[model samples]
Target chain A: MKVKTKHIMNLFYIPALLLFVAFVVYPFTQGIRISFTNWNGYSQAYKYIGLDNYIRFFKDKNVLGAFVNTIIYGFGSTIVQNILGLAYALFLNSKFTGRSVVRAVIYMPVMIASLIMGYIMYFLVQYDGGAINDLLILFGKAPVDLMSQGPRAVLIMTLINILQFVGISMVIYLAGLQNIPEMYYEAASIDGVNAWGQFKYITLPLLMPAISSAVVLNLIGGLKLFDIIMALTAGGPGYSTHSLSTMVTNMYFRGQHAGYSATIGIFTFIFIMIVSNIIVRYFDKKEVEM
Target chain B: MVQNNKRAAIWRTPLAIIIVLIHFAPIYILLGMAFKSPKDVTSRWILPGYIYKQNFDIAINKGNMLAGLYNTTIITVSCIVLIIVFGALAAYPLARNRSKFNGGIKAFVLGIMMVPPLSILVPLYTVMAGLKGTSTYWGIIVILTAFQLPMSIFLYTNFISAIPTALDEAASIDGCGPFRTFFLVILPQLKPITASVVILTGINCWNDYQFSLYMLQSPKIKTITLTISSFFSQNSNNVNAAAAAALMGILPVILLFLSLQKYFIKGMVDSAIK
Candidate 1:
């Protein structure tokens, strides 16, 4: 009877599973099938071109560029975001006056839509009468067009993302810090441990869960960056700043290559899975050691 | 050591104020841009001495912001309610049942989180178009709920797991079936987590772009982000008006975040580490 009741309870999840099937799983399988065909996205008629789309992607320079940019966007921002966030968390956790106000100010950006924030940030980076250029002009320096270059534009976008979302990591760490009882710190003090020693020996090890959560969250987010790229570059300045996410969109919408787009999509899905799994496993091992 | 820390705090306060100003600069530029006339091609750093009301006027009329607001509100509210209900409902059994099958279900849900919306953009758009779901409120709501459900379920699962099973056992002994036991016993206890889910998922649904871009392509059905994007695309020259529209987009969220400051911060933290 108990087992039967439990099975009945399990049935409650069927609606959610069905929705996932209809939206995510079904479309995902369809994407794989479409990747083999020469469908231009709109028309029903097309031929199965088997592995050619994948072959083209492997040989394509744009795909290579986008792949590299995606990694840079992912790991680059995650490294900076986590370190900076941990620092801010440490500083604010010490109960300074206006700490709440400071935290709120930093967090304000995360509330704005990324698409809109991208547009807003563009105001500062725009060439004529822009904020950065105005400062350069203050020192009588020639105004440089920031977004016109590829590597420079990519770095700026990564910095923008880190600045915007760093508050999230800080607050996560703040909570983790609070969870550690004051007694631990007091005991460390009695043992004559220095501040750095206490942090190294006592605080860092205990905050492992929060650290993993912040790092993984930032990594996954950075990997899937799309809206900001759309608003800022539109995968433009000659496809140099495109992430895989934006690349997929541009392929389908502008280049009229639905089949090829689906192939790249599959690549992105698998790549994210492998990378995130590796990161998760790495953290899992560290967690066990701690 | 305590005395040294206090002295350090005095120096840190000024540094903290500088950080706050730097973080707040974009919004300052945005505010300046929105209130300035187009003829005033001054640096974005300079604030307009007087209000320029025409920018907001142009944004509203040209950007279709009123329709966008209405459509976004309907979609956001409906998606939030569905995500909360479905996410919480789905999490209940997965939290309670320690079976291998249920464990696999939980992992699959987590896997769904890693699939970027753009990766599935092609087939998902094709499927929605086939279903005549393009430009429809119900269509976008369903899609948004599905994408946003995983985080909510993850939070709810951890939350429900911490809940004592003794309550369920007691309810079952009192002649309550699984459904009744859940409704009567487990559901009320979920108020705190539900608050977190609402803030977290609510923000996502409100700020969603990719799904809404494809699903709600019609101008009449455009959300705030779509409307603003279209406005920008139409005229790169219309910086002031676009700034106004973008300001409009940022205001509701900023105001909500300020009012519900605790929940917003707590929701962000809970969704991550807790």
Candidate 2:
């Protein structure tokens, strides 16, 4: 009976495992293989020119730009998101009426897909009669064409990304704040710790676990930023706002650079693997000490 | 001290309110302008003088919003149901059995949760095409299921393990087989995690654009996200109609979120922090 029950339990795993292997493992391996080739994505004939695709990718100006932009997007958004999120979470942790409503409102953007949010942002940022420009005109100031510049466009993209996701970090931080014993705060208050001191010594230390998770999750999400960039800028005013993910999509779908696209994908896979693992390890150690 | 606390609330609450308002400003613009005519939408008016019904008509008739909505509903519902069922079932054995195999599977699922789907985009699309999965509802469903499975399983397994082992023993002693015990005794107890899985996966599959962009390229099979996206690009000149399409497309998901926000927020925090 025990053996049969064990077999049945294993049987339950078969469907999920099969689909996972086929869809995830198989394609992942194929992506690696195609990266070493010189396939144009149309004709069946192609040759594996070892390391040439990776070599070209390293040399390509656009690829390098995208790599840098992805890093900026990831780190830039992660930093801003954590700071703002922690602040909001701390504020919301205080007693107030309509608190849940406020949290839901703040988190509302997180529910909207980034792709749609990007489209809405485009309307607001457009130069001619855009909402932001119109608001500026109302204020008797000259309108700024924000998205026209490469750096500014990337900055706005990062800001938009931050706005959409900060609530997630906030919610996470709030959960962490809830986990801390109230007696700690009470004891600190009795001992005459200032707000800043209490926060620095009590809240911040207690919140480290939440901080690590939020930062790493946000970092991963920001690195994978694509739909928003695609919808808002299409990696332009030029290729200035392109992340590696968007660049891969563009290379494969539009530019007909299949092998090159796979190479970028592989590069992204390895890079993300290294970066995220390093972050997770670093955080795991911090969490233990805290 | 009480007075000081009151004073702090006065400033803190309003500041929090401002932050939320700022976050929602774009959505407000999107909805406000969606009802205006093209001229009024582009103008400096905060709200339209009168609502124009033509925007919705145009969105439905021309922008493919209706067909997209229909397809999106089918896909989202089907995907959510399958995710919950499969995720719970797979998580069960892993949660109950303490073996090296289960341990490896758990770790692999967690690792897959971190992998960016874009890393395998080209090959996944190619393989899907070979299987004739592109442009088909089931194909996209399968892909979404596979991609979302790791997270689903992780959440479910964690939740299930917290449930007591005595329930399984109780069911088995009552003359139930493993499958019957699972379906009858264990499955019903999985409501909370199942709710989490539903909201998380529903929002994901509903709002998905990247996969739909490549897989469901055909006009007839386009999801609401794809429809709204293509409409925005094609009709950039007509701001009102585009906003209308966008508004209509997002309304369902927004409504769903609003209704289940308690679960939604809890699920998010639960899934992430674990």
Instruction: Say which candidate scores most in DockQ.
Output: 1
The TM-score, computed over Cα atoms with residue i paired to residue i, of candidate 2 is 0.97
Which candidate achieves the best lDDT against the true structure? 1
Residue B130, candidate 1: Cα error in Å is: 1.6
* Model 2 lDDT, residue B101, Cα: 86
Per-residue CA lDDT of model 2 for B1-274, tens digit only, reads 8999888978876786787678778888887888888766446347776898899999998897889989988998888888887888889889988689889988887777777888899899999999999999999999898888887888889988999989898988888888998899889988888888888778888889889999997888999889988898888888888988888877877887899888988888878786
Cα lDDT of model 1 by residue, A1-290, tens digit: 39999899999899889989999999999999999998998876899998999999999999889999999999999999999999998888887789999999988888888899899999899998788899899899999999999999999999999988998898998999988889999999999998899999889999999999999899988998888899999877999999999999899988889999999999999998898889888988998999
Question: What is the lDDT of every predicted structure here?
Answer: 0.91, 0.87
TM-score of chain B of each: 0.96, 0.96
Question: What is candidate 1's CAPRI-style docking category based on DockQ?
Answer: high
Per-residue lDDT of candidate 1, residues B1-274 (tens digit): 7799878978897889899999999999999999999999777889999999999999988888888888889999999999988998999999999899999999999888888888999999998998998899989998999999999899999999999999999998999998998899999999999999999988889999988887887778899899889999886897999999999988999999999999998898888875
Where is model 2 more than 4 Å wrong at Cα? Answer: B41-45
